[model samples]
Target: MSKMTGAQAVLECLKREGVDVVFGLPGGVLLPLYDAIYQSDIRHILVRHEQGAAHMADGYARATGKVGVCIATSGPGATNLVTGIANAYMDSVPMVAITGQVNTWLIGKDAFQEADITGITLPITKHNYLLRSATDITRVFREAFYIASTGRPGPVLIDLPRDVTVDEVEFSWPEVELSGYHPSVKPHEMQIKKAARALMDSSRPVIYVGGGVRYAGAHRELFELATKINAPVTTTLMGIGCFPEDHPLSLGMLGMHGTKYANYAIQESDLIVAIGARFDDRVTGKISSFAPRAKIVHIDVDPAEVGKNVRVDIPVVGDAKNALHGLLKEVSPKARSEWNEKTETWKKDYPLRYIPDMNVIKPQFVIEKLCEIAPDAIITTEVGQNQMWAAQFFVHKDPSKFISSGGLGTMGYGFPAAIGAKMGRPECDVIDVAGDGSFLMNSQELATAVVNDIPVKVAVLNNGCLGMVRQWQELFFEKRYSATILGRTSPDFVKLAEAYGAVGLRATKPSEVEPVIRAALATDRPVVMDFIVSPAEKVSPMVPAGATLSEILELEWCDVAQSCHLEKIYAEGRKEVLGQEEF
Candidate 1:
């Protein structure tokens, strides 16, 4: 076996594991690692902040279906990554976060920059390790990647003490062994059969697709199953893009800010075929009344999530693709014509809407135009109004196209994520749909993009307030408007972009929305398009906190309550794209 330093082994292992790029920041204890990085062929993206590194790694993983890697120093650097790590954990993104630790002898002395990162991230990570020796480096790295990419993919951490990185050790690719960590790839035949029966027996069935479908690369399988069963499909927020929104059967998205039709469908269905979904509160409001009449058939890769949130009548705990493939083989095509008509009526009657004021640009309209013009751009979103508006208005036609902070809902996720996604797929255009409040959280990353020559685009829905908080304050808190306003302190986004050596553009009126977006996209450099939008806008069809789907309140729905707001032209366009007239 060749003898090399632990830092060298880390790089060698990464090369053998097929990792070409890593996002990270260098610190004191990581000096040795950085020196090794300089001598190595692997590409390292220098992020402005450690948090951006973690988020960028997450975005890369989501875009490429490969394990993303991020590295950071001890103490503050490691702690900064907590939010992004938790975000990836909540959404189950595959990632490996490496952190430098204090010297082994000084670990317990609380030396400067020392931190117990493994203990701090215990609850959030799938698994974590604190290196004891240089020899353990290869085995630990292999294990970290294996654990992160397997069974319900999630972030894993490896805390390497400074001494371990510098110490020399014998190098050999040891066999990865975790006797208790077996992930079931093939599900039980009996469970699949049971699920098939439940799906076929019920006349009113809804297919609830989740993020697991995307993780499993099961979009085709999901498509086949949805069509074969003839069920109306609704995706959780994390599940977006797993099923095509333009498809007649799609109910857009379901949950707090979900389509009213989808909530109604869930309320009335006799059977729900939940594929690779965990029934989180965001997706299932008021669990007692959620799918009250429907028997749930949950399919997931992680056994723990099968019935954790909602009761399952049939549980198939295995890989989503395998379970879906098994389901496809057992179930044959069936028609529920009455059910189809009912679902269509719900879709037509309660289509997503906004009272378009021509004087100011509406965020939803901006998203609609974005989808129209940049049909092929990969989208990442910050949490809050921009995220919901993007979810509501954009028609996603491909899997792995829509990336956002689903579980943790980190505010600054989109911009760095966009940079990472662009790096992962350089040929495709990557855009960050951000709100003013969330954009400022990691706005400094503009320097990272420009300096690295990563030409990612950002569309800021600048409402001049914390949009979601303002909406809640208006509806629930009597519009007190205490700390929700950001207009007084918000930066001039155009100036901010220009300061970072990036192209900056703004759209204040409805007419300039398309032009600004087009111009930003036309630029080969990093571009930020700030759309000054109305603060009064709210993401409609909102299910109030702790309320059942039946209790959903649509803001504009009250205004257009008398008649359906859906246009004939929209359906015609959808048909033209889908290339079929009949549903």
Candidate 2:
């Protein structure tokens, strides 16, 4: 047994666990860890901030379906990682976060840069470890990675004190053999049969998928099941691109800001097969009223989520891909021509339509144009309306093509996530569809893109307001637009892009949208385009909290102006089509 520092032990443990890369920023307490890293085989990516590192790890995990690793020093460094860790937790992305703490002697003395990172992150993590003994390093590291990548995947933290890093320890890697800690991925046979029966029994059925599918590596399984059942599939924000959006059976996304047909289908379905999807409040607004008439067969890796928000007739606890394979074996193929016909009728009737005026360029039209220009580009989005717009308008033809922070709904996620995605697939064109408010959160990372020569296009939907929250207030809170307006006196985004040594363009008119987008695409450098969109625009088919899906408030230009009491013709000369009733 060779003598090694705690930092060395940690690195040895990571190498044993097959971790090849770590995303993080170095700090005072973590100097020894960095020293160890300098002599190690593991590749380290130094992000601009600790938060970005966590997000980068998260993006890598989501894209590759592996345990992503991240490191940060204690106190401020650990705190900065909180948002990204919570984001991964909410989305069920597997990640291991290693942080440095103050010396063991300063545990509770409130020493310089000392903070109880483990305590701070307990709620957001699957599990946390504080290495009090050098010998415990190997075991804890093994356990952390196992916990992170298994069952309902999530971020796990291991906080190591600075003193521990300098201590000598016999280097020995322990093989993972914790029986109690083993997470169960095999669903009970009875429950699996029940889930299959539910699918077989229903005439009008739809598969509602969530991010759990991606975590479970069940995209192919999901596609197979949907094809066999001949049922249309819809995704939550986290589940975007899990099923190819370009597929005829794919219904895009469903919820408050989902496609008109997709939302209507969920509202009217007789049976809902929910896989690896927690019924998030955003996805199932007015929980009691969501899928009012449907029997839900909920399959998730985590059992706690089975009935937490939405009641399930059949709750199957297993990995999504595994459960789908089992269910597919038990269930026989059945025709639902009537159901398919109804969905088709609804799709043809209430198609997602946007009236593009020659005056101001519509955000939806711009997204559609983007789809035309870059059909296979990897699209990431910032939270809020821009995310929903991208989900609705972008035609995703492949699984894992769309990336966004769904559960955390973090605003500053797009730019950094885009960077990670670009790094992951250098050959693919990556774009961050961001709103004005959200873009500013991590726009500083444009330099990261430029310096790395990661040609990611940044499309800013410059509505000059916090679009989603403003829409919510206008609809439900009697138009009390408090702090929602992003007035004209905002930062000059073009100048900001120039500051980062990136190309910037401002497109204010409809005619200029395509040309500017093409120009950005042609450039090898990072490009930012500020598309001045209509601020009066509102996302439609909003089913407010405690309301039924059928009770959707269809938003139109008139509704926008009426709700805000605006005198201007919000959507002048825009055509409207009446929706058809189908089930």
Candidate 3:
């Protein structure tokens, strides 16, 4: 054991945990910690805001499957990290956020720049700490990383008071032992068998996937199980990159703005083999009507999630990879020819499409071009229509290729996230698909990018308004468009990019989309490519709020005709099966 200041011990602990980089900002209270950071070999990316640091760490974690770290000062600095912490918490991203507090003597005295960061982040973090002594520094850092990266991974905070940082103590890493925090990693044999039997007996089975599968590194097992059982696979928004969308059984994303085929397939399936998926309201649409005909076999690491959203016929609570391994033993290969045929018909009937208009560029067309240009790039998205469009148009074949804020749906997440992703995977292409309103939120990060020489690409879908909210206003609220539009006074994104010493390109027509995207991709410096898309264009096949999946509304008549035709085919098939076979 060696004697050292708490700040030095913190850096040492981080080094032990394989943390090479941190995203953060410094303040008065963090002086000692920043001094320690400066002396250490660990790379620190100075962010414009504490919130950006949190998001950058979150993005780093999501991209690399490693625990991300961020630091901030007390009071407003700590508070600024709240939204990013909440975003990571809601999406189950593994992160550790450290904040410096005022001196211990000043505690509870309402000192300047003093606020209870631990209390403020209580609801958003998996676990948090308030360091009362230098002696506990090693233990706290160890536990923080452990808790942050463990089962149901999420953001964990550690508050370091100024006195604690300056105090000297002999340190030794403690053996982590916590009584009520064990996560189940093994499934019951009987439960696995029972789930297998259910899947075997069902004529129409669909596998519903979520982010947990990716987090647990269970995609291999998940893929094997689905392929062996000949079941169609539909993923939640968070699960987009977990399954190969190009696969024959891939139904792409389901629910809300999910593919028409996926929604229909889930509604018609007899069995839902849900893997690491929570039945979020967006995915389920109307809960009462969602998968009304199906029995669900829910496999998750968290026992609390088994029946929290929907009733499960078989609840196997364990690590998703292990649970999938258990199921693989009991499940046998079977040709689901009829079910496959139905899904194929659905796929053929309603494909994601848009009418070609050369005058005004459609956002979907831009995304399609991006897919063609950099199919293997790490794609992050800002919330709203850009997110939905990215989910729909981008074909993600590998896990971790797509990252976004799902549960919280935070805007301005993608750019910083892309930066973090680029930092984590320098060789891989990192692109942030963003909206104009969302991009402007954290666009100041352009300075961070240029300063650090992190060449992340940004695709701004500029519609001159908050397109998603405007769509809602147009459809449901009688076009009472509230403070959504940015108007003509909005800053020119290309000029703004130039101001940041970054390349900026704009595409106004349909033909210009591909070339502009290509130009952005070719740049070695950070590039912001703004595509001025139509303000009137809306996401199609939308299931209106409070509506069931079957009641999805299509933007065009051709889509309506196709959906109707698929329903007719299904009705006829059901009648034939009822009259003749036991299927």
Candidate 4:
């Protein structure tokens, strides 16, 4: 066997693991790896910020169902990736983050660029490795990739010392033999049978799906089982497109801002077949009251998540597709005419509705117009109001169509994620649905788009404030509006786009919305549209925290007309009816 440098070992390991592209920024400590990368076949994408690199890797992993890879150097470079790593950890995206560390001798000595990245990222990663020797390079990489892409997929870190990357060792890529780290891919047979039995017996069963189905590539299996059993489906925010929103059985998204009918169905169902989804607090609301009457059959790839939050009558731990297939075979279909009728009643009563007033421009209207113009376009969104609005208004017909920071809810995710998604699927039109606040956080990436000649359209909802938080403060905190307003004299986003060498448009009136969006789409260069929407608008049908899913408060048309002054209307109307005698 020939002697190879640590950098060569890393490249060999990545090749063996089938890593095609790496998202990263190079630095002094990682010069050896960069040198080897120059000679290797793997492609490297240099990002503007290290955080952007990590998020790009995350987007790639979520879109392709592969373990995304990212690299950064010691100290500050590594520290910059912390937010993205945490984002991946929260969402359980499969990724491998490799960082260069100071030489082994200087690790604990507070050397110029030294930081304990492994220690810093321990809570946010599935596992982490600190490589002290050249021999450990190959094994650490193999282990990191395996852990990242396997069961309960998450980010894993491998920190390499600068000296180690240049050191020479005998090169022989050994097959990984992890005796102590076997993941449970096969669900227990008894648990599978129990789940099957539950499905067979229930009359009012609804399948709740989430991102795990997408991760496992089990969309077909999920569709097959749901169709076979005639069970209506509801999805968490992460599971939006796993089942097509237009499907007859699909009840759209369910959560804080979920459809009223979807939340009601969960309340009334007798059996909830939750597949590849966690009962996140956002979805469940109050654990004690959520789906109070329903028996749950929770199936997931991770055993630890089986009963982490909600109690499960049946728990199946395996690949979601495989386990679902096993259950389908065991269960016999049952008739449930009454249950279907009840759900249909709820659907008709509380159908998703938004008034399109010609006088004032609405955010939902812009989203709908964009959807009409670019039906198959890929969409990335920042967190908060824009994210929820996209989920509510956008119609996604394809899998991997909508990319956003779901679990992490990272604010500045849209622009860079759009860049990465565009890079991954270049033929498709990619757009970032961003709020003004979130857009400013990563607006710097417009330079990256302009430099690469990537024609990503950014639709900025310039509401002049943090709209979502302002809504909360308006409703719950007595309209104090603390630190929520962007105030007057906002940055000239159009001029900013022009300065970055990208096309810009401003849309204020409702009539200008579609024309501006179409203009952006017509461009072959990066474009940003400053869509000035109504600042007073709020995402309605909000379910308060620690409340039951059924206890949703819908903001009525009258409420909107009164500018959220519901108490005054209530007092006046009731007093008039009662002749003020009771008072």
Give the runs in model 4 whose Cα sits over 4 Å from its true position.
334-336, 557-583
Instruction: Give the alpha carbon lDDT tens digit for every residue of 1-583 in model 2.
Output: 8898988988998888888878888989899999999999997877778888888788777666778888999899999999999998888878999999999988999988888999999999999998888888888998899889988889999999998888899987678887777676988899988888888888889999988887777888888889888889999888887898777788878886777778788988999999888888878878777877889999988888989987888889888888989988988877668889888787788777766677767888889989999988888889998988888888876657788898879998888888777776778888899999999987877876777677889999988779899888877888877777764336778888999999999898988999998999998889999998877677765667666566666667543444233322222211111122221
Model 1 clashing residue pairs (backbone):
none
Which lDDT values do the candidates have, in the order given? 0.90, 0.83, 0.89, 0.85
Better of 2 and 4 by TM-score: 4
The worst-scoring run of ten residues by lDDT in candidate 1 lies at 559-568
Q: How well does candidate 3 score on lDDT at residue 26?
A: 97
Q: Model 1, range 405-438, lDDT digits (tens) per residue?
A: 9989999999999999999999999999999999
TM-scores for the candidates:
0.95, 0.92, 0.95, 0.93
Pairs of colliding residues, candidate 3: none
269: Cα error in model 4, Å: 0.8
Supply the TM-score for candidate 2.
0.92
Q: Candidate 4, residues 187-248: lDDT per residue as tens digits? A: 88888888888888888888999888888888888888887888889988778788888777
Cα lDDT tens digits, model 3, 1-583, are 8789989999999999999999999999999999999999999999998889999999999999999999999999999999999999999999999999999989899999999989988999999999999999988899889998988899999999998999998979898878878978788889999999998999999999999899999999888989998999999988887789999899999999988999999999999989888999999999999999999999988889899989888898888899899889998898868999999889999888777666767788889989999999999999999999999998888778899999999998999999999999999999999999999999999999999999999999987778799778767888666776664336799999999999999888999998998888888999999898766678887999878998887875233343233335435555765689765
- Best candidate according to lDDT: 1
Clashes of each: 0, 1, 0, 0
Of 2 and 4, the candidate ranking higher by lDDT = 4
- lDDT for 334 in candidate 2 is 70
True-structure Cα RMSD, model 4 = 6.9
Model 3 vs. true fold: TM = 0.95
